[model samples]
Target: MMSVCGYRWYPEYTVEEQYRDFNQRQYICTVRVFPDYPGAEKPIHWSYGLGVTVDMAVQDAAYSMLTIMRARHALLQNSELCYVPASQSGEEGYISGVYFDSSMEDPLLQSTVEMLENRDRDARALRMELYATRARLWTALTQLAPVVQTGYGEMEMLNPVRTHLPAHVDWPAIGGVTPLRGPLLPPVRGPRPHPCPYGSQGS
Candidate 1:
């Protein structure tokens, strides 16, 4: 394919091995083609394949890449054909000197883009609803503040127990004693007189 396309560079291959057990192993091969010519502006074309041996994996990967290139008309049998740059083609699917069918209108890419758009729309809607809800709550609180204050004032004026209560109470000084700070307890009445020593006459 490179020779027909007037490319002098060779395709690079990388292999990796996955050992499932002592007797079971899987090999994966990746083939990448880089632009070697000076005036050729092309992105790297790559493909992957899996097999039981390194040679088999490499062959599989190479075959898959060639198949893709053939489908895209990237490989030309006649060297006399003029090459077209991807930029001049005005199509995103065009790479190197050929148009790739998969690059344009791919179902996976379309679906992914649609999914992201929907997610973004939902997020924007949620944020708008949150802002509106917050604004309504703030308005309700602002409108209710004066009514609440007036009701509290009326209750304070009508309650006689509250009116007679002292604003503050001073704790009596006790030697080496500290006064506890909390809700005040009612003052205790004077201690009751001791009972008579003798029992009641009726008893």
Candidate 2:
């Protein structure tokens, strides 16, 4: 089961955006394309290109999208046709050649499996804290102004506790010590469900 019987096919993409930080006139372009597989929860590959003109950016993006599509198609159909945007040399500006990578057990780009698991754990903790905070607010309001009418024939004004109040204060976890993950996806690429030649670690 550890050995791959055949190569799996998946789309690859890259997206990039470039702009001059000091220039207000520069435009930023984002291009995105994918296989559009139905019911796919994983992300699609993309590339970004920054250029002085809109045409330049669009041209690069289109070329990149085509390059990835052709590569995948060739691998899947076992065709002799192959697209190598640049030479194998890892030069600064040249396109790096594409090749098959079989180490699918590795972590996704910018993220690790362990980190993702920890995020889930942290999310559960934060949720519990949120519920605790809500409960405290309800209790405080009840005590301040119970089910009674004021002399003016209106509910008395209750100074509810501040929203910033801690649900379960843990000094050790305050500040940047234990930053909340919130709803952020890991800053890493996840393994493809089906292996692709671009650099799939597993099938």
TM-score of each: 0.34, 0.28
- Model 1's lDDT to the true fold? 0.47
Candidate 1 least-lDDT 10 residues = 81-90
Worst 10 residues of 2 by lDDT: 1-10
> Over the stretch 1-203, how does candidate 2's per-residue lDDT look in tens digits?
00111212433323233321112112233444433446555545455443334444454444544445554453533333331221222355433435433234344522443443355345435534654665575566555443333343234244322224254642222111322323422233764322221232332
Give per-residue CA lDDT, model 1, range 1-203, as digits (tens): 65665454577777777533112345777877766667655546777766555655676566556645544453452333222212112243321123333334457665554554455445435534654664565466445545655764442222123112233642222222223533323333565222222222231
Candidate 1 ranges with C-alpha deviation above 4 Å: 38-43, 74-203
Best by TM-score: 1
TM-score of decoy 2: 0.28
lDDT winner among the candidates? 1
